[model samples]
Target: MFSFGLLNLFQLFFLACFCEPAHALAPGSSRVELFKRQNSTVPFEENNGT
Candidate 1:
């Protein structure tokens, strides 16, 4: 249970690191585009697939 909570925290951190730049770089961009950009750079998603 403790590890699960830690994993959630890590996910949030990664999300912040990932989304923050998109907002800074293009504040006017649509959310759909930001999501596509995020999906393209999924370091964790690749690992999960393996």
Candidate 2:
């Protein structure tokens, strides 16, 4: 049980270290963008403008 706990701790530590670079350079990543689209049609709106 102790070994399992130790392994889990090491895994968590490795993940924390691995993710550091992502957050450090997050602002410069061009693939990241923010956009919003608005749909004005009501839920019950008819398909044709009848």
Candidate 3:
């Protein structure tokens, strides 16, 4: 029973982090927004100048 509760607590933490507004998670930190922006940013490709 204790293990189940622990698991639930972790799940709740993830849900809150993913569901809450970016500002709510970190007041003025913009951590969540940074993650969202990272997902949309283009990844750099290896430029092998042959």
Please give the ranking of all candidate structures by TM-score, highest first, separated by commas: 2, 1, 3
Alpha carbon lDDT of each predicted model: 0.76, 0.65, 0.74
The residue ranges of model 2 lying beyond 4 angstroms of the native Cα positions read 28-50
Model 2 clash count equals 0
- Per-residue lDDT tens digits for candidate 2, residues 27-49, read 64533322111333434444497
* TM-score for predicted model 1 compared with the true structure: 0.51
Error of 1 at 1 (Å): 0.3
In angstroms, give how far residue 16 of model 1 lies from its true place: 0.5
Whichever of 1 and 2 has more lDDT, that candidate is: 1
In terms of lDDT, which candidate is stronger, 1 or 3? 1
- Give the Å shift of residue 25 in candidate 2: 1.0
Per-residue lDDT of model 3, residues 1-50, tens digit only: 99999999999999888877655667546686567567876764545974
Q: Which residue ranges in model 1 land beyond 4 Å of their true spot? A: 27-50
Error of 2 at 30 (Å): 14
